[model samples]
Target: MNLDLLKRTRMYKGYNQYQMAEGIGLTRQTYNYKENGKSSFNSDELLRITTFLDLSFKEVNEIFFDNLISK
Candidate 1:
C-alpha cells in the first residue's frame, strides 16, 4: 500500500483519522494501525474508504495497489 499517498489524500480531503475510522465502521486505534501499516485493511474497509474519500478509480489504484503494480 502507498501509505504516504493514502494519508496525504485523506488529509487533503479534510478528513482526520477519527473521522476515517468512524466512516469505515472501525475504531480509531484499528484505523491507526491500518494506516500505520501495523495492520491491513479488509476489502470492505477499502470499499468504504474509497466511497468516503470520493476517490476515483485511478486514485484508489495508486493508493491501494501501487505496490502490486510495481511488482
Candidate 2:
C-alpha cells in the first residue's frame, strides 16, 4: 500500500497523522488507515490529501497510479 511513502511524507512535512487528517477533512482513524495502508483512499480523499500536502497533481498521480498499475 506504500504506507511508508505516506508516513514518511507526512513526517517530512512535520505534521502528525491527526493534523494531516484534519487538513484533508478525514477522521483520524480513516486517515490512519490510509497512511498505514490498512485501507484504500477514495478519489476525493486522495485529491484532498495531495492538495492539503501541497503536492503537485502529477506527483501524487504518479505515486498512486504506479501503485495501482503494479498491483
Write model 1 residue lDDT over 1-71, tens digit each, in one string.
Answer: 79889999999999999999999899999999999999999999999999999998788889999845542
lDDT of 1 at 40: 93
Q: lDDT by residue for model 2 over 1-71, one digit each (tens)?
A: 35677678788889998899899898899888877778899889878878887876555655566534431
Model 1: per-residue Cα lDDT at residue 58: 83
Q: Worst 10-residue stretch by lDDT in candidate 1?
A: 62-71
- The residue ranges of model 1 lying beyond 4 angstroms of the native Cα positions read 67-71
Question: Model 1 lDDT vs. the true structure?
Answer: 0.92
Error of 2 at 22 (Å): 0.4
Which regions of candidate 2 fall more than 4 Å away from where they truly are?
67-71
